[model samples]
Target: MFAASVAVLLGAWNNVVITRLPGYPQSYVPVNLAATGLLLAGARFAGTTWQELGLERRRARAGIGWGGVCAAVVAAGYAVALAVPAVRPLLADARLAGAGSGEIAHQALVRIPLGTVVWEEVAFRGVLLAALLRLLPPRTAVAVSAALFGIWHIRPTLSAARANTLADGGAGLFAVVLLGCAVTAAAGVLFAWLRLRSGSLLAPVLLHLATNSLGALAAAAAHRPG
Candidate 1:
């Protein structure tokens, strides 16, 4: 939880600054290094091998298949809901403006280097999940991880939306924040489940990559004026 919190905080800070700053913060490099170092350090201290963490080399297909399936589900779910009138309003609201800017910003955000994604999955789902699995029951570890994931996003996302509202008051923007959080929470849970089932962080990382890449692609496609 502590590591995840730090990662999220770093990401949030990076998100806030990237817009105004001339150069994007090279966050992924440091985050990946730190996460990998920390995990290895922990394993060394615990007198355990990589295989113990269930990170032993497995059939490549297992990772790809599991991750791909989960990613497909999440992406398909979001895409199918595009036609839902209620969903559109909740996602954009007055604060978010049209989908164009949102998509552009989202694409920029997800381009945080694939290495960072691997580190995050390893740290959050691999090392952390393994620790929690031993300390708590399987179900409890999954729930706690999911909950943490949700909480991690809340601060940055809500802060961004609220800042927009404060700069230019948007009526009922808080409702949009609430709705977005709920949707992300659902995603978090599903991602956690993928992590648990695949028995490797690779699954969640691939799923994340797929979702992010698709989102960015879709957002770019939507940026064009009809």
Candidate 2:
């Protein structure tokens, strides 16, 4: 069951990257939802409970509260970035530029949370982390899951960085990919820590949503005609 679960997860993930299916930035909704369902099923079959999956109802309130605070902080940070000329580039990712207002709204409201956040929180912080904890120590589980989460971003990183023309030759692109992966891996560790601290996936989900969704909105604002 463990091996099957791993294979299924990896297969689904690879397919998403390889296919660039239906289309991206939004196409991932069904793909992630399906992968999430399969992972949950495999996890349950292997004796992992919903609470172990980081859906603990008792912790939900605390998680949501903490998450909301963090989300607000992120929003304020983005607001400041938008206000400042120097730091605005931090919010204005070139790869996400040129989007229409409707497209930006869809990305922030629908695609980001549903396509990106939901399944990711459930899969990494929820399923994989719980499964690993059953077999390994808690720290080791977090490390391994965080590492995998980082690796998961490699392809997407390559695609986005290329779109932004962030690097030049092959070696430069390789360097960019390495740097991107390293950053995401670090972020994964932080997200994992938040999951461990809150004991409910809501905390990380809201944080992730705010980070991506707000950034998308900020990028659109930055690129808007002035």
Candidate 3:
């Protein structure tokens, strides 16, 4: 329990760094990598084997395959959402409004996949979930870890809402946070399921990569001038 608490605290710190850091392009890689290292070290200190953390190679192919299926389903949902006019603007990112093709490509292919996706899976599913499983039932661990994962997004979601003015004021911001947490917690359950099913982080990593990359692509597309 102490170890799990430490891990969760570390995750909260990482979230602060991720959302509060300046010079995002310059700071993101180093910040996330350092956080990943801390999570991995914490996992080891908690007596978690690399394999148990889903860091093994034995089921690589199966993990990737299952991840692909999950990504496809998510992509299909995004497509359907995009088809709705009201939903389309929600996908827009003002930051990407003036991004060139190369910038968008780098964001989708490199920045997101290697930076955000990898570190998040390692911290949330790899370390936190592994620790929770030791202290709680599998389903319970998944739920708790997923809830933490959702909570981890609080800062980012609030930052985005503030930047986008998605809400009217304080009450609207509160509602947005609640809604975002609920949705992300549900998504976290799916991610946890992938990790448990494959017994590997590869599956969740791939799913995350697909979700972020595809979502960035959609945001870029939406922000582009007609």
Which stretches of candidate 1 lie above 4 Å from their native place?
A: 1-24, 48-54, 73-110, 113-116, 159-179
TM-score (C-alpha, index-matched) for candidate 3: 0.88
Give TM per candidate: 0.65, 0.90, 0.88
lDDT of 2 at 16: 56
Per-residue accuracy of model 3 over 29-147 as CA lDDT, tens digit each: 77778778877887798689888788888878878889988899889977876788778887898777779999999899877876789888987788888877778899998898788
Question: Comparing 2 and 3 by TM-score, which wins?
Answer: 2
Cα lDDT, all candidates: 0.58, 0.80, 0.82
lDDT string for model 2 (88-206, tens) is 76566676677777878888998788878988888888888888888889888888887787778888789878878889999999999889888877888888888888888998999
Query: In model 2, which regions exceed 4 Å deviation?
Result: 1-4, 11-26
The ten-residue window of minimal lDDT in model 1 covers 88-97
Best of the two (2, 3) by lDDT: 3
Rank candidates by lDDT, best first.
Answer: 3, 2, 1
lDDT of 1 at 177: 59
lDDT of 1 by residue, 156-225 (tens): 5677577456334454665665665676667666766776676666677777776766555444443333
